[model samples]
Target: MIVSGKLLVSLSLLVLVFKVSHGQPLVPALIIFGDSVADVGNNNNRTTLVKANFPPYGRDFVNHQPTGRFCNGKLATDFTAEYLGFTSYPPAFLSQEATGMGILTGVNFASAASGYYNWTAQLWGAISLDQQLNYYNEYQSIVVNMVGEAEANAIFSGAIHLLSAGTSDFIQNYYINPFLRGYTPDQFSEILMRSYSSFIQKLYGLGARRIGVTNLPPIGCLPASITLFGSGSNQWNIKLNQDAILFNNKLNNTSQTLQKSLPGLKLVVFDIYQPLLDMITNPSDNGFFESRRACCGTGTFETSVLCNSRSVGTCNNATGYVFWDGFHPSEAANEVLAGDLLAQGIDLIS
Candidate 1:
């Protein structure tokens, strides 16, 4: 198909902007990775097991169509882009109508159900941070092609680089303690942290200076975990959620270590640990009604059933609820989360 006059102009501008700006912000781009939480729509396209393209997933948005996003509506990353002045939460470049198309301020590299480990996909595993890296590389190539070397470099340097992952490393991956793999909790944490650190360094090498990393939230409080511990009881078992607290601490600690290693990498750790802790401890303050059971209905009443299960029923009021499914947060929750992340105004890179 012939390029439209508008796209032709967009392309020309993309190239010209790159040629002129050596290391300036072409525009900010938001790249996502990891599991359901950040998964924009990888599962929607991939035939993999880790998927969420069912109905009720997009109930809050237009058409109420499930786009395979884990949430009932917009994701935290989506709101982040909106704050930075982007149209709609940017779609996955691979999922976009045109792979070569470039938006003024954003792009989402997050693939639904992806994880750091390669085979995680087959197991319905979330996108691994490692696999997400591959996507990032793809994103770079697209940026290079669309904006040219000079402009791309400027964008990388000037644009804010948002990295939110690792939660899947705990929730989706059974290796939180790696005991199942025969490794102790400490042992597993060590290996994962090292691997994660290496990944961050690689990202820095690729020109990610302004890094916004969201630490893992309270995993134990996840609807799935609650369902498991609460059994038939609706109360969230606090003791069980401790592991999530530990993991978030580890993720945060690792971020500090990474900052020391990458002198130039401005790392801003969005302390989700404390926020989630406070929310669960005091739902009213954080704006959550039910913290344990998900609003969606499954035979089991957790998120075992996708939000839009043909047989199961969806929650009546998504906004009033905290979690949309067993694992993902509701759009209302994500909106609040986005505002929280932006509360202090990030000066990590600038």
Candidate 2:
């Protein structure tokens, strides 16, 4: 007898509820790795131009203090932590809080402008994916020392590991870099896929059982992409969107294959593309008034250093805007995205 997808999901959720009801935390922790979308403040101390630990970046966060998050407030991962009953969001691995008892919940190793390819991050002076994994290895040792081996093992195996990358690989490196342009988009995505598979396998080796990877968002719809590739027509770049779709398709297929081959691996590919595209295509339906541009600066192409306290024409509020800057989603948008992500990734916790 075959079970319907909806029934499988419902049964998985029931198991999750049972675990929680029995006093086990929904998941022991949440471990994060990837690019700017998941980076809390890892880039703040790094020698990278992609840093966002300044005014107007975290204007909606606690005390309105910038925490190096690309958004005006929390990211989708931050909301995921809240949904998982984590009182305090996981600390960045490079931050002061990633010490004794502080990192018991988990740690964020994501860096802005980083991608699956080391060169992609190297070009921007951001931490590479390999480097992020190295940091995770270091974090694992620290956790072992703090909590003893058995508990540490439990946390490592039980935590939900999240990865959100790929956008920067194409937008920040492949498309613009002359040397990388030698390879077709398919060839480049294959390279990225190899890196992705390696990273997941390494994480699995490090004891991560539950993993959730976010697929690429609508790249062509990003204000910066439109500005750079839309021929000044203020429209989505068709080729770039197609590239995103191609990468996402590969990501979904690879995730299925990994789940089948890897023992006890609960891998889920969260579809960030469609939810974001829906908001961009019909902003009013999602209670968002602006989706074509961002809330910062001119809202067309401003991001990172270009989006600052001195940015002219910056909106006072970002609640109605889908994007906070040229590349990252606003807090309101992240909240909506998080709901969708949790719904899709419930099986990971189960």
Candidate achieving the largest lDDT: 2
Model 2 agreement with the true structure over 41-92: per-residue lDDT tens digits = 9999888899899989999999999998999999999999887877789999
lDDT of 2 at 164: 95
Worst 10 residues of 2 by lDDT: 16-25
CA lDDT, candidate 1, residue 320: 67
Error of 2 at 343 (Å): 0.4
lDDT of each: 0.65, 0.92
Off by over 4 Å in 2: 1-24
Model 1 per-residue lDDT tens digits across residues 304-350: 23445663556688776777777777788888887667653345522
Off by over 4 Å in 1: 1-27, 98-100, 117-122, 175-181, 230-234, 298-305, 311-313
- What is the model-wide C-alpha lDDT for candidate 1? 0.65
- Candidate 2's TM-score: 0.95
